[model samples]
Target: MQETAYAKINLALHVRSRREDGYHELETLFAFVDRGDTLLAKRAEQDQLQVVGEFGGALDDPFGNIVMQALGSLPRPDGLAITLEKSLPVAAGLGGGSADAGALFRLVERAQGLPDDWRQRAAKLGADVPACVESVTCVGRGTGTDLEPIDSDLTGTPVLLVNPRVPLATGPVFKAWDDKDRGPMPEGTAREIAEAGRNDLRDPAISQCPVIAEVLAALGKSEAWKVEMSGSGATCFALFNDVEARDAAARAMPSDWWQMAGLLR
Candidate 1:
């Protein structure tokens, strides 16, 4: 079986407060793009994984990869061989790993079924795993595990993702946060919320990787209805009104930078 690990982007992220558990209280809008890493799998006597593609080298330790952990967490009568095609950059705040694991979960689900405690198992893997399992637009809260599904207004909107070829880890960016409450997400449709809302991590991320600002600036030059940094850093996205405009913006981006254009899922 094969699955596409849909790319995740935060339409808007708000850091509510730092919890005693060391996780931040967050309110964010999660959206997925139609493009991302690809995972191919088949039944095997023992579980195995092979990583290949542009960003595959960064996740060379197969056993340590989240995809393996996701496989170990589930129950299967037979093992499976998973080949992960790493198209997305590592640590770019695109939820690349979580999306891969989620794709694996879906593949397992289709072949067999998920346990009743699937959500708990997914949360243990990563905060974003639960959301990525569904890969739909929703509102996430409390460390991004508490999810509330929303009727997204921005579905099918053309989007362009750009990266500065720099990997910014999530830890340092969170540490740099001012720790001020930015208030809750505004009440409105997905597009409306995205327009009025903001990514609280943008400034902190820019402090770690200044090129993020340049990416946002470049996307801002487009005719996008909304342009903002996704999740923590490095990868910023612009939501355009049409595919032609988005494609034009993609071509105009710096040749040295990496970019992908697709419609929102």
Candidate 2:
């Protein structure tokens, strides 16, 4: 089976508090984008993984990759070969790795006829894995594991994702968060969540990578839409009401930056 593991951008993020486990409690509105990595899995005589693609060259340690981690958790079949065609930037807060892991789990479930409880297994890999499995907008809480499904009707909304090409480490961004206390859930429906606008990590992320501030400024300069940073840093996005506006904004973006304008799937 083959499937695309879509990347996600945080529409709104609020850090509530620091847990005793050293993980931060957070409330965020998550939405999957149409752009991301691709995975192809086929049953084999033994369990194995072969990764290849544009970003594939960067993965030296296959064991450390979430695809391997997730596949390892499943019952070993006679054999299996999986290939990851990576598109999302690594460690860019776009949940690229997490999505790949989720896709692997789904492939295993389908090929092995496993039970539906694999989503819990996906969560064990990362907080974003579960949502990536669903690949839709959701409200995530409690270290980003708990998920409440939101409407999936973002057909008309166009989002332009801009990665400054600077890799930002998530650990440092969370470490720099000033308030560890959790906050009340933002009011209103999913639409409100998307339009309300917030990213708890934006300030700390900018502190970690000053170029992110410049990315935001550039996004703001465009009259196409509302802009916000996703997850930790380095990757910012703008939401436009329509594709025409989004295309105009994409054209206005600097040539040096890595940019993708597409509808939220």
Candidate 3:
């Protein structure tokens, strides 16, 4: 079986409060883009996993990669071989690892005839895995595990994503805002995300990596563009009114930075 693990951008992320378990309560509108990783899995004569692609070198430690974790959670079938094609940056708050785990779960279920309970097992691996498994626009809350499906009409919107190439740590970003209390997202369409609010982590993210602020500024300066930081840090996106404007802004980005523009789906 083969599946694509799509990357997601937080249209709006608001950290509400801290929970007893030390996890923060957050409300965010999550949207998946056309860019991300890919995974190919099949039954092997012997149980094994082989990953290859850009950024695949970093996943050498089997235990550290979520794909291995998801595989371990499943019943030992005949055998398995996995080839992971990583396209998204690691720890960029784009849910790359989680999406890979979700893809692994889906592939295993389809090949082994596993039950739907596989998603529940996926949740145990990571909070964002369940939503990644669904891979659609939705409302995520409570440490990012509670998911409610939203309208799937965002495919028409255009998005230009730019990664500053400076990795920001998500732990420190949340720790910087430990005492802050953020407001909730108002009920509305995904198009209203720009006016909803900003991610509380953006300030700390900028503090950690000053380049992020510059990226945000560059995107915001574009006419008819609404720019915001996705998830915790580093990867920022600009929503344009049309594909032409989005492509123009993407082309205007710095050559050293990583940028991709596509119609949101």
Candidate 4:
């Protein structure tokens, strides 16, 4: 069986306040791209994983990979041999690891079935895992695990994702936040919320990786309807009205930068 680990992008992330537990209270819009890493699996005597693709080298330790942890989290009476195509850049605010784990959950779900406490299992893997397991546009609150699916107007919209080829870790980015209540998220369709809302981490992320500004500037030059940084730093996205416009923007990116163009899932 095969599944696509859809690339995740935060249309708008509002950091409400810093929590007493280290994690920040968050209200964000999570959207997935139709293109991302691919996972192929088949029954085997033992759980085995092989990573291959453009960014596969970044994940040197197969045993340490979150995909393995996800496998360990579930009750798999039959071992599965998996191959992960790592197309998305690591630590680039794309949720590549979480997406891969989510894909594993999906594969297992299809072969057998998820347990009643699947959400809890996903949450233990990561705050973003639950949302990624569904891989749909939704409102994520409380550190991004609490999901409320919405009728996303942005569905099937053309989107271009660009990264400066820099890996920005999530911990430092959140630590750099100013820790101010940005208030509640605006109520509206996903597109409206994305347009009206803002990613509070933009400034902090930019402060950490200044090249992010260059990417945003470049995307801003396009005829995109909206351009903003995803999750934290390094990677930014532009939403366009049509595929031609999105592909044009993708072509216009710098030669050294990494980019992918796809429709929103």
lDDT tens digits, residue span 162-230, model 1: 999999999999999999997898878999989999999999999999989899999988898899999
Estimate every model's Cα lDDT from 0 to 1. Answer: 0.94, 0.81, 0.81, 0.94
lDDT of 1 at 92: 91
**Global Cα lDDT for candidate 4:** 0.94
Q: Give lDDT: candidate 1, residue 26.
A: 95
lDDT accuracy of residue 263 in candidate 1: 85
lDDT of 3 by residue, 18-75 (tens): 7889888989888888768888877887656676886777678876678878878888
For the record, the alpha-carbon RMSD of candidate 3 to the native fold, in angstroms, is 1.7
Model 4 misplaced regions, further than 4 Å: none
Residue 71 displacement in candidate 3 (angstroms): 0.8
* Candidate 1 steric clashes: 0
Query: Compared with the true structure, what per-residue lDDT tens digits does model 4 show for residues 1-265?
Result: 9999999999999999988999999999999999999999999999999999999999999999999999999997999999999999999999999999999999999999999899999999999999999999999999999999899888999999999999999999999998888788899999999888888999999999999999999999999989999998679999999999998888899999999999999
Query: What TM-score would each prediction reach against the true structure?
Result: 0.99, 0.93, 0.93, 0.99
* Candidate 2 residue-wise lDDT at 143: 86
Better-scoring candidate (lDDT), 3 or 4: 4
Error of 2 at 65 (Å): 0.9
Find the 10 residues in a row with the least total lDDT in model 2: 180-189
Count of residue pairs whose backbone atoms collide, per candidate: 0, 11, 0, 0
